[model samples]
Target: MNAPLTATGVRFADTALAQFLCTNRYTSLDELRQTATAAPRRFWHEVVTALGIQWAKPWTEILDLADGPMWPRWFVGARIDLYDNLVGRVAREDPNRPALRWEADDGATRTHTYAELDQEARRLAAGLAGLGVQAGDRVALYLPMCPEAVVTMLATTRLGAIVVSLFSGYGPDSVASRLQDAGVSLLICADSFQRRGKSVPMLDDARAAVARCPTVRNLLVVARGESPAATPPDGSHWHTVDYQQLIAHVPVTQGPAIHPADTPLMLIYTSGTTGKPKGVLHTHTGFPIKAAQDQLMAFDLKPRDTLMWVTDMGWMMGPWLVFGGLLRGATLVLFEGTPDHPGPDRLWDLVRRHDVTHLGLSPTLVRLLMAAGPAALPDALPDTLRVFGSTGEPWNDGPWHWLYDTVGQGRRPIINYSGGTEIGGGILACFPGLPQKPCAFAGPIPGIAADVTTADGQPANGEVGELVIRAPWPGMAAGFWQDDARYIDSYWSRLPGVWVHGDWAQVDGDGHWYIHGRSDDTLKIAGKRVGPAEYESALVGHPLVTEAVAVGVPDPVKGETAVCFVTVADARRLAARPWPEWERELAEHVGTQLGKPLRPARVHLTRSLPKTRNGKILRRLVRSAYLGQAAGDTTSLESPDALDHIRQCRPAGA
Candidate 1:
């Protein structure tokens, strides 16, 4: 049995969930756990009913997977358009109700109601049709997190056109690759965005990429930031638009709503072994359900809650945050600049101002914030704050505890969620009603058949193994976009029928789950396998240390030896503090947190670590550099310079 969870940490205001608690009151954590375990299908069905999903054509079957693998249908015959469901229905109820609240790093904010969003979506959809974009035609959206991007997505989906959301930070090559793969008909981008205190020329890159994409015919440019010094050549032909121009011309007409349950809504491309990107196709029912379910359970989402998760359109979390927040009728706050750019307290300031109920972040970002000190965080938040969710990379107990103590008052839960772009939502998540354990996931969500198995496919306890989902669920991506064979080979080939996600996991005797690290980064040192997260977790416990990355480099004797890269609070001061004085203390700290055998062979101090736009450490780049291999994809790196600094460092014991 799991540890008894007590409801003694955080309390809620007279909020949306407070009434739910009163009507169907749960006194203890055990009661909440029992409610979920006792009737999971009933819980989900209730969620569906509560969300009030419009059924234009009634569903013949809510869910059907009986035939075999590769075929799954949800809300079988429901004919409601996803865009219509999100915007139309909501607007019909209260057109003036705020649907999107956008805030930039400059403190500029805009609020758009459901009617405004619907009208903008209609105009955007009409503009695309005028540009000759047809159903199933891919439209590449390379814009920042604005109302335009959101409306563009819904408009495209409404027309049955697959929307490919490209990260605004993506360069020409990255943009060209996705555009070519998708055979896009239209390209949407902004003039530029403010990044690192400077205006970036987003349109310049989009123009360059469009030149390479033969299928791209029209360019819809949102005039934002500074006016570009040089516009696209006349022959290239650009249709200029501002916040109003795009929506002003077109009439509001609900487009055709397609329903297949298997029909692809979005094509999200992820990196593959061959260095080619594989598009992960997500359908309406599967994607929406997973997003709604995960957010509901993982963060204890309620209608009155306000959430802010830092992410870009390119990353999966971008969509995850959107669907998750909206599905639960929660308020979503978006920031258009770096989380710590110009200052460290940017995120926390937003949190305090918005009265955010749940804040989702990654460990790498937490480590960066820790380096800035807790002074970077705001002192108080809404007394209603209940959950803090994290993902992207493995977390340390230090940040885990800090999240609870500082932000959550030691009572709120730090949900360590793990999943991939293809999974749509987290496969493993910690529920608010579960016992709060530092750096440990509560368990696999009920209805999800999850386990950590050895290489031979046998289950193990307290031993790190491959995390796999044994059963097909509603949210599994249909397949790689237009690459069926690669999709089959990537996920299904490893273990026939079982979804073998490339993650390392462990389970305690009491059934708590823990993500070790990515399976690819699992280090084999002197015949013993160790997860980098284990050592990173240990290093985080040090008072002066902020963040660390453990990479396995090829060694003549050990096959692979551990090399740790550290970013500390007083980076230069710590380096000059004399290892003779503090080395023993630091070594002892590691020994206490992790076993002696798992200690890093060498520790190299650095000022900063490379991170992705979504705040994941670029461990692959670190490992590739140590192994003298190519840095496969630097497109996602938040700081490309960190890899160069790592490459210039001397080898261990040199």
Candidate 2:
């Protein structure tokens, strides 16, 4: 049996995870993993039924692996509709229950009950149908975190039309590329949204992108009490449809369409280190089941709990929040504002005011918050706060502990969840029912048969190795849309049947799981391999280093050496010191934490780090930008201009 890293200091004794496992006759999480994986079909049936995901027809088989593990289909003969299960069912059961709550940067708020959301979704679905969107047609969504974003998502999927999420910050080219690639027939976007008390005209980019993509028939605009940014060009073929007009003109005569459980419900694109971005297809049963199950296991999310994860629709967590929170009949707090907009206390104030029970944040955000210190936040969390969810990147011990001590108040467990647009929810998670640790996942939550493999494909015991999944779970992506071969090469081709999750992971002596960094970002200095996170963690461990990103640079003797870029917590304090002296001290710090051999060769101070919309550090892009090489697939980057700062960090005569 896997031992706990610490004593069973479970914050919640009767956690949803423990109750579900015990009720199913399992003794512990490990036992559940072993037994459920042994009977995968039966386990899925029980899980789906327990999660309240109803089916129109019973499935003859839970899974079919005849097509191989890379393309396993789920719920072979069952018929299900995500909207009906997520909204219709809940609205009927408790119509007045709050489905979603929205708060803007300006302190404006809006609430939607299950009944209201259900009707809005149905009405939007009818509007899309009236506008000529058919089942299986792709509809792109490029709106901010608002009520319409969620409604449109449900509406599109309700009509069996696959909803494609685009990052709200994407420029014209990036937006046009995904739209053209998906053959999108319609796009829903906001005219503008407030961030830091400033209006960002999204319709400008949406119009610019749609003009380039001939396949888009209509550009639907969600008026955010802001006027349209610009008039359409004279020759633009797509019509601009007001969001309210589209919904108001149509009356829903029917409910959601029943689809095969394995039918494509959503398409999410994942940009890699190289090559074109791959679109991951998710089924009605696949993503939602894994999302809800993981939420229950990891966060102990309940019907009364309110969840708020800082994410955009472009990322997986956005859809996960919509489906998982609503599928379980939980309230959602949608904050469409920057964390430090009005003040550093903006996030904490949102939590306190919204009564958010479960709040999710990224390690990057926590580091930023630490700069302002605890005094910038509330004295204590609201009484409603219970669970803390964290993802997007691996946490360093410093930020993780700060989040635990300051924000979590030493009571909440910072559930470090790790997964992607492809995996649906999480492969590893920190269960609230298990022992707590600073920066470690308890293990695979449930359904995920996670394992670590050595360089030779042998089992890795208490050693750093490739994180691989031994068995296919229901949430696995159906395939990369229109690119089956690329999908195979991405995950399955490397280890045959085993799914090679790109991150390097390890199991420590006490059975704690930790992610080092992406496998592609690992540096081999003199044939000794180490991930960038090690170097980054060492730098950020210092109180002055608010953020850091490390990448490999070519070396004459060592083959590869680490180059770390960091943002300072105190600009004035850093400016007081000479660059050479500070660089020496930082390098020595890393040497002290790791070893002399693994110390970073150089440290450069930067204003900011390049990150994705969901706050994941773009290590590959950083390396490319610094090395003056071609940066590949930068569509997912939240701030492309940050690359210029890294490029300027390049030293002369180096």
Give the TM-scores of the predictions, in the order they appear: 0.91, 0.97
Measured by TM-score, the strongest candidate is: 2
Error of 1 at 35 (Å): 12
Candidate 2 — worst ten consecutive residues by lDDT sum? 1-10
Which tens-of-lDDT digit does each residue in 386-450 have in candidate 1?
Answer: 67788888878777666677756666677788888988888787776556467778777644667
Evaluate all candidate structures by whole-model CA lDDT and list the values in order: 0.74, 0.85
Clashing residue pairs for model 1: 9-411
TM-score: model 2 vs. ground truth: 0.97
> What's the residue-level lDDT of 454 in candidate 2?
91
**Top candidate (lDDT):** 2
lDDT of 2 by residue, 549-617 (tens): 889999888888999999987788877889888999999999999899888899998888899866788
Clashes in model 2: which pairs? none
lDDT of 1 at 113: 76
RMSD (Cα, Å) of candidate 1? 3.5
